[model samples]
Target: MKNYKLRRLSDQPILKTSDVKPSVDGFEVLGAFNPAACLVGDEVILLLRVAEAPRGKEGFILVPLIEEQNGTPELAIKEFNEPAAPYDPRVVTLNGKVYLTSLSHLRIARSRDGIQFTIDENPFLFPARMDESFGIEDARITFLEGKYWITYTAVSEHGPGVGLAITTDFKTVERIGMILPPPNKDVALFPQRINDKYMLLHRPMVSDIGKPSIWLAESEDGVHWGNHRFLFGGRGLADNPFAWEGAKIGAGPEPILTDEGWLLCYHGADPTHSYSLALALLDKNDPAKVLDRSDAPMLTPELLWEREGFFPNVVFSNGWIQWPDGRIWVYYGAADSGVGVAELVRE
Candidate 1:
C-alpha cells in the first residue's frame, strides 16, 4: 500500500534498555522482544522483549535485571565457560572472549499509566523444551469468553511456526502445542467466533507458487483449523518496484472490530528486508473481503535507534491494546533489539 501514513509517538526510545534489568559480569541488556499489553488493576501492563549480553558472544545466555550501578538497566550473562559448548557466532561477541547468544524471552513490566514502565522481577514466559527451543516472539492476546488466548511464534531449529497458549490468569499459561506448522506464521484469531466458528488470518509461504500472502481459515474449535483460502496478494507500485509486499504481509494484532469494519494492523516487508507496519479494513462478517488498506507504512524505521540496531530498518509488532479513550497503543520491537510504543487514532 502507498497512501497510508503513521505518526511517531516518541521520536526517541521512551522505554529503552533502561526500562529492563541490567547485565552483570560485563554483559548488558541488548533489546526487547515481542510485547503483549493489557489493562490489569487499572494499569497498562507490558510484556517486553529483554535481550541481554555483551557485544559479540557465542555461547552465553543473558538474563536482564535492574542494576543499581550507574543506575542503568543491563543484562547479566549465564556464562558456561565450558570448552565443550563452543560459542555460536550468530550472537554478538566482544573482545577475544566468546559468549553464547542470548535467546529471546517474555518478561513482564507494569505502568500505572501507559507511558512509563517498570519491569517485573520475574519473566512471564520462557522457551519450553517440547517445541519452542529457539524462542517465542510476537504474541497476540485475545480475552475471549472470559479466558485469555495467546497465539505466538514458537521457534526452533526446525523452523518458525505459530503456537497457542491459554490462560485465565496471566501468571500461568497452558501450552496448546504448535497450532500451525512450518512455512507459516502471523496467525491472529478473531476475538469471538462467527457463526459458531473460529476465524483466523495466517500466512503460508510458497516460494515456487507465488510471493508470501495472507490466508484465511476457520475452525470448529480453536485448535484444528481448515478451509484455508488465499485472502490477499501483493500489488506492485511504480516508485516502490518491490511493492505489494516484496517479501510478505500477514495479520499483525487481533482485529479490532469497529463500526467502519474490522481494523487490522499488519506488517509488510520489502525485498530489501526492511519491515514496516500497515493497516487494512476488512468486512466485519466476511473477513475475506478487504475494504481498504494502507498503501504506505503506518510505522517505519526513521529514528536513529530504530535505524541502527540489531536488525536495522525494522519495526515489528505482535500486539496492541485499545483503550476506552479511543486511543490504540501499539507496542513493537525496534530493530530486533528492544521494544517501543506508538499511539494511533482508533478511527
Candidate 2:
C-alpha cells in the first residue's frame, strides 16, 4: 500500500448534498456519493448517487414508499417512531416488507483533471419506471463498442433490481428498462467483451441464509443475462482486524483489463459495517474462474473522510480509471456524504 500513494484529493468532495428537491421524487437532496466514473472524450464523467428524503415531521421518521395504484406509480409516506423504523438508516421494514428511508437519483459531474469537478445542477436520471419508484442509487458505467452503458440500482418495494441506460453523446440517453429481476445491485460490466460475449459482475442481496457474494453472468448483446455462477464470497473473521471482509462484499469499479488477467477491486465490510477494499483476478477467457484473490485489503477506511459521514466507516465506489502508464485512479464515495479519490501505482 505504500507504493500506491493514496492521498485525498485537495478538492476533497467534488459533489455534495443538494438543497434542491427532486423535480418529481422527494423533498430535498440529503447526500451524494458512490459515483460511477469513466472517460468521455477528454472529460472525466461522474454519475453521482444523489440521495433525498421527504421533509416530513421531524419527530416521526417518515419512510417514503411507492405503490402501483390505478395503473400508475404513486409515492406514499409511512410515519414511524425511531425505535420502530428499520435499524439501517437507509431502509425501513414493516411486517416483512422493506422500504427505503431515502430516495436516490443520479446527477452528472464532469472534470478534466478528475479532481476538480463541475456537477450538473439537476439530476439526469431519476425514478421514471415503476421498478425505480424508490429511486436509483449506485451506478456502474462501461464504455463498450462506442457507447457508454449504465447499469444502476433500481430500488423499490419489491427489491433492488438492475436497470440499463445507453448514451452515445451524454446529451441523449436511451433507457433499456430493468434487466435484473430483484434483490440485486452492485453491478459492473467489462469494457471489452470476453469470448465475444458481454460479461457482468453483480451482487444480489440475500435473505438470512446467504451472504452478499459476487456472481458472474453472461450476455450475448450486453442486455439479456443468464448462466449465473458464483464468483467470490465476502470475508468475515481473521487474525488481524483489517483482514476480515465478513459483513458483506460487492463489486466496486468496473474491472480493469490488465496483461495478467481481469483485475477487479471489490469492497468488503465487517459486522460493524466497516468497509474496506480488496483485489481479485478473473480468467480473461472465463471470468467465472477466479485466478487470484487478495488475502489482505488494498485500501480501507482510515482517513476522516472515509471514517465519518452520514454512514460512517465506509469507502465505496462504482468506478475507476487507469491511465496509459499503469497508474490507476479510484474515485469513491466516503461515508455516503461526499466523494474522494485514491491513486494506485502498479509495482
Candidate 3:
C-alpha cells in the first residue's frame, strides 16, 4: 500500500454564502456549501446546497420551510414566540416539533480552474415533494449510463431519506423520486455496475440498539434497491484508535475506481460531534469486502473557517473531481457554511 496526503489549498473557501443570492424575497443566504461536483467538457460544475433563512426578529424565532400551495412549492416562514431554546442553530424544538433554521436548495456553480466559481442566480433543485418539504441537502453525483445521477438527502417531517435525480445538461433535471425510505441518507451510486448489478452506498440511522453506519445496497434497475448489508462502522468506543468515527460515519463523494480498489472518501463524527474526512478502499470484485481504511482522518477542522460558523467544527464533503493523472480535487463544506477544496495526492 502507498501513503497518501491531503493538502489544503491556499484559497481556503472557494465559495461563500455571500456569493449566493437567496431564492425567496425576504430570505438571506446563510450557507452555500456541501457541493456535488463533476466535470462537463473543460468546465468543472458544482451543485451546491444553498441554505437560506429570513432575518431574525425580536422576541420571535423564525423557521424557513417549503410548503406546497396550489401544487407549487413555496418558501414559508413559521414564527415561534420567545426563548425557543435551540439544540443548535441548525435545529430547534418548537412546540414539541423539530424545525430547521434554514431551507436548503441546490444551486449551480461553474468554474474553469476549479478554484474560482461563479454561482448561478437561480436554484437548480428545490423542495418540491412532500418528502423534501423540510429541505434537500448533501448531494453526491455519479456519472453513469450516459447521464449524471444525483443522490441527495430529502428531509421532511418524517425523516431524511435518499432521493435520486438525473440530468444530461445541468439546465434540466428529472427527479426519480425517493429510493430509500425515511431514516436513511448519504447515498452515493457507483459509476458502473459490478457483477451485473448496480451498487450503492448509503447510511441508515439507528437509535435504540445501534449507531448510524455506512451500508451497501444493490439495485437491478437503479430504482428499486435490495440486498442490503453493513459495509462499515466505527471501530469501537472511546479507547479505540478509530474513535474519531465513534459517533457515526457516512459516505462522501462517489467511489473512485483505482488500480488498488475502489477509493472512497467519507466523513466520520466523534462523540463531540466534530466531523472529519477519511478514506477507505473496497475490494474491486466484491465491494462488500472492505480492503483498507484510514487509521486517522486525512482532513480535520483546523483552520478558523473550518472551526467556526453555523454548526462549528465540521468538515464534510459529498463531492470530488478526479483527473486522468490520478490527482483528486476534494470540495468540502467547512463549518457547514463555506465550500473549500483540498488536493489528494499519493506521496
Candidate 4:
C-alpha cells in the first residue's frame, strides 16, 4: 500500500473569527462549499452553504428565515415538535413538546487569497417554495465549456433531492430546476466532458431496498441524464455491518485525472458516525471501475477545531483547486462550523 500524506494549508480557520462578523441573515451552521474555487476576473470565488436557524433555541426540524433583529438580519429558528413528525437525531424532546431545528438557505463568500473570505451582503441562493422549504446544502461547482455548473442538495418535506443552477458570472445564477428527484443528492459533475458526454456522481437513497451508495450517470447535454450504474459501495476488511456505507461515503470533488488514474477524494463516516476523508483512484476511461481505494482516511479530525465544534470529528471537502505548480488546495468544512483548507502533494 502506498502512503499519502495531507498537510494543512492554512493554520487557522479561513472563513471564521472575522474582525467583522458579516451578517448571514438567518444562517447559523455554514459548510460544504463546493468546487471551492472559481475564476472571476483575477480573483477566485467560493459559494458556501450557510445553514440558518432562529435565535435562542434549537430543535430537529423547522424552517429558517431572514428576520431583522435590532436592524441586523439574523437567522431565525423555528421548532416543529409534533409527535407525528419524522425522526431526526439533532432535535431534543421535552414534556411532550417536540422541538425541531430550523434550516433555511445558502450564502456566498469570496476570497482573493483563497484563505481570508468575505461574506456577501446578500444571499447567493435560498429556498423559495414548499418543495425546497428545508434549504440547500453541499454544493458542487464544475466550470465547463463557458459556464459554471452547480449541483446542490435541495431539502424539503418531500425528501432531499439534487438541484442544478448555472452561472457565467458568480453574481447571477440561472436555475435549471431540480435535475434529480427525491431521496437523491451529493451530485458532482465532472470538470469537462467525458467522450463528449457529461458525467456525474450521485447518491440515490434506497432505504428499504438497499444502502446509500455512489452511482454514475451520463448526460449528453448536461441536463438530461441516463445510463445510471453503481460505481462503488461500502466494502473492505474495514467495512462492517455490510449496510449502505456503514454510515456514508460519496464523491468529494471533480476527479483529478492523472497518469496513474482518476484521483478521487471522498468522505466516509464510520459506524461511530465520525467523518473522515479518504482517497480512491478509478480507471481513466471507465471511471465507474474502481482501481484502488484507501482503507483508512487520508485526512481526519486531528486538529482541535476539526475535533470539536457543532459536530466533532468531521473534516468534509467539496472543492479543491489544483495549481499549475502541482500543489492541491483543498477547502473543506470543519466540524460543520466554518471552512478550512489543506494541501496535498500529487504523487
Candidate 5:
C-alpha cells in the first residue's frame, strides 16, 4: 500500500468461521467473508457473507446443493470425491455443472472503533425467497432517500444475481427481491442521485462466455435497471495486463464522492486468482464517463494472513467509512479467513 496507511488490524479476524451460525441445521461453518459495510450513527455495521456446508468424509468433500420437492426448495447434501472434484476449496465442479461447495447467508457485525466488532450470531439475511435459495453474498449499502438501500449478490442454483433490500432501522429490513437478473453481481448504488437519476456501479459477466468486468447502469426508480453501459474493461485475449487485474474485475466499496470526481475502489483478480484492490475516478455528473483509472493496485496480498487462509492470495475490500479527518477506514477480507482494516489519506 504505497499511498495508504496500515492503520489498525483486528487482533484476530473481526469475524471468522467460529462467529457465524451454519445456514443449514446440520452444516458446519467454513468461512465468513466479504462483508457489506456502512456506518450507522457511531456504529459501523457490516453484513457478512458466511459460507457453510455439511461436514465432509475422508476422501470426499460434501457439496451443498439446492433441490425442489413439492414446490419447495430445500438444502441437499452431495459428496464429490477428492480426486473427482475439480475446484479449489471454494468452487467445485461435478460432471459438467459448476456448484459452490457451501451455501452463504448475510449476518451483521457492529463496531464503534472500526477494529473491534460484535457480530450478530444470527443472520441478518438468510435464504428465504426463491431468488436467494442458495444464499446471499457480499452486499454494498447506499444511504439515500432517508433510508439505507442494500445491493447484494443473491446466489441460487440457476446463477448469481443482484438483490435489493431497504431498512430504516437495522432491526427490520424490507427485501426488494431480484433487481438485476442472473449473471450479474458486485453492485453498489451511488450514495446520492446523479443528474436526477440513480446511477449504479455493477460488474456483470460480459457475456455467457466472458469474464466479469465493471459496468454502469441507470434507473429512474432504482428497481428497474436500464441503459446498460460498459464502464471499465479488463484485459483481453491477446493483451498484456497489470498483474493484479488481468483476469477479472468487480465493484468494491461504495463509491466515495470526492471534489475531483466520484472516487471508486474496486477489486481485480489476476489469472492466478490473486485478488487486489484498485481505484478509479469517474465524472460526477456522468459516472459512466471514466475520468482516471489506477495503473497499478493500491493493495495486494502481502501480510502472511493475507497470503494464507481459506483462499490464498487475496486482499479484498467489502466496505469503508471515511472519517471527517480526511482519512478513509476500509474493512477488507483477507484470504477469506478474516477481516482487516486500512486507511487512505490525501497523498
Candidate 6:
C-alpha cells in the first residue's frame, strides 16, 4: 500500500461547539461537528450535525426531545431525578424508555477558504417525522443527476436508520424519507452510477451473529437499495479487532474517484473505541473489489481537542471536498465536539 499523510491545517479546531448557537431557544450547543462538505460553485458548504441540550440545572437531568405542534417542530424536555439504567452520558433510560442526552440537527456553514466558516443561525434540517423524533445526523452528500442527494442517519425510538433528502440550492430541501431502515448508518453514495446501477456504502449494526462492518448495496434508483455484499471487516477478512480498527469500522467521506480507482476514506475504532482515519482503494469499475488498503491509520487522535470532548478519542468524517486542482480537503469531527480540517497528501 502506498503511504498517504493527512496534515492538519490548524493546531486548534476550526469550528467548535461554542462557534455554533443552539437551534432552540432554551437549548445550548453541545457540539458542532461531523459535517458533510461539498463545493457549490466556488464556495465550500458544510452540512453540520449540531447537537443541542437544554440548560443544565442542579438536581434534575434533562433529556431533549423534538415534539411537533401545528406541523412545526419544537423542543420538549424530559426531566428525570434518576435513570432506570446505569448512568451513561450518551443516553438516559427511565421508566423503560430510552432517550438521547442531546438532540442533533443539520445546519449549514459556508466557507470561502474551507478553513474558516460562518454557520447558519437556524437549522437546515430538523426532525419532522416520527422516525426522526430524536434527530437527523452524520449527513453524506452526493451530487447526482442535477441535484444533491443527502444520505443521513435518522434517530428515533426504533433505532438509527439511513434517511435521504434532495436539494438543488441549500435554500430549499425535499425530504425523501428513510432509504434504509433501522440499525443502519454511516451511508455514503457513489457520485456516479457503476454498471448502470447506483451504489452506496453502509454500516449496519450487528450484535447477535456478527460484528458491524462496511457493506455495499446497489439500486436502480437511489431510494430503494439492495444487492447487499460484504466488502470488508465483520467476522473474517482481518481488520476486525486488529490494532487500530479492532472494535468496528464505518464509511467516512463519500468515495472519491481517481484514475487508479475509487479512493475511500473511512474510520476505524479499536477496542478502546478510539477512532482514527484509514484509507482504501476499490476497483474503478467494480467497487466491491478492494485494490489496496492502509495497514495503519493515516490520521489518528493526537491533538488535545481530538483526544477530549463530549465523546473523547475520536476523529470522524462524513464529508469532504476534492477541489479541481486535485487538492483534497478532509473536514472531520474531533472528539465528537468540534470540526477540523486536514489536507490529504499522496506521495
Most accurate candidate by lDDT: 3
What is candidate 2's local distance difference test score? 0.81
Q: Score candidate 3 by lDDT.
A: 0.91
TM-score of 3: 0.97
Please write out the lDDT profile of model 2 over residues 94-151, one tens digit for every residue: 5576778887889888898888788887778877678898888899999989999999
Error of 6 at 216 (Å): 0.5
Residue pairs in collision within model 2? 235-245, 235-246, 236-246
Off by over 4 Å in 4: 1-3, 17-35, 57-62, 65-100, 236-245
Q: Encode model 6's per-residue lDDT on 201-276: one tens digit a residue.
A: 9999997877789999999988999999999982223344356886789999789999989999999888778888
Query: Where does model 3 exceed 4 Å of error?
Result: 70-72, 84-87
Q: Per-residue lDDT of 1-347 in model 5, one digit per residue for the tens? A: 24433444444556666766665677888778887788888888888878888877888878876677688876677776776535567776666777788888888889887777787878787777777867788888888889999888888767889999999878999999899989899998999898889889888866667678899998999999899998987753325657568788998978999888898889989888889888888998888888887777787888887888889988888688876566788788888877778776555
Ranked candidates (TM-score, high to low): 3, 6, 5, 2, 4, 1
lDDT of 3 by residue, 1-347 (tens): 23878888855688987899988888889998899999987889999999988987888878988788898877778998856443567787778998888889999999998998998999999898889989999999999989999999999989999999999999999999999999999999999999999999999999899898999999999999999999999875788887789999999999999998999999999998899999999999899999999988999999999999888999999999996666799999999889999999888
Please give each candidate's TM-score: 0.81, 0.89, 0.97, 0.83, 0.90, 0.95
Best by TM-score: 3
RMSD of each: 7.1, 2.8, 1.4, 5.2, 2.7, 2.2
C-alpha lDDT score of every prediction, in listed order: 0.71, 0.81, 0.91, 0.70, 0.81, 0.90
On the 0 to 100 scale, the lDDT of residue 212 in model 3 is 88
Query: Candidate 6 regions off by >4 Å?
Result: 68-74, 83-86, 234-241
Q: How far is candidate 4 from the true structure (C-alpha RMSD, Å)?
A: 5.2
Cα lDDT for residue 229, candidate 5: 90
Q: Which portions of model 2 miss their true places by more than 4 Å?
A: 1-11, 18-26, 65-70, 74-88, 94-97, 238-243, 324-326
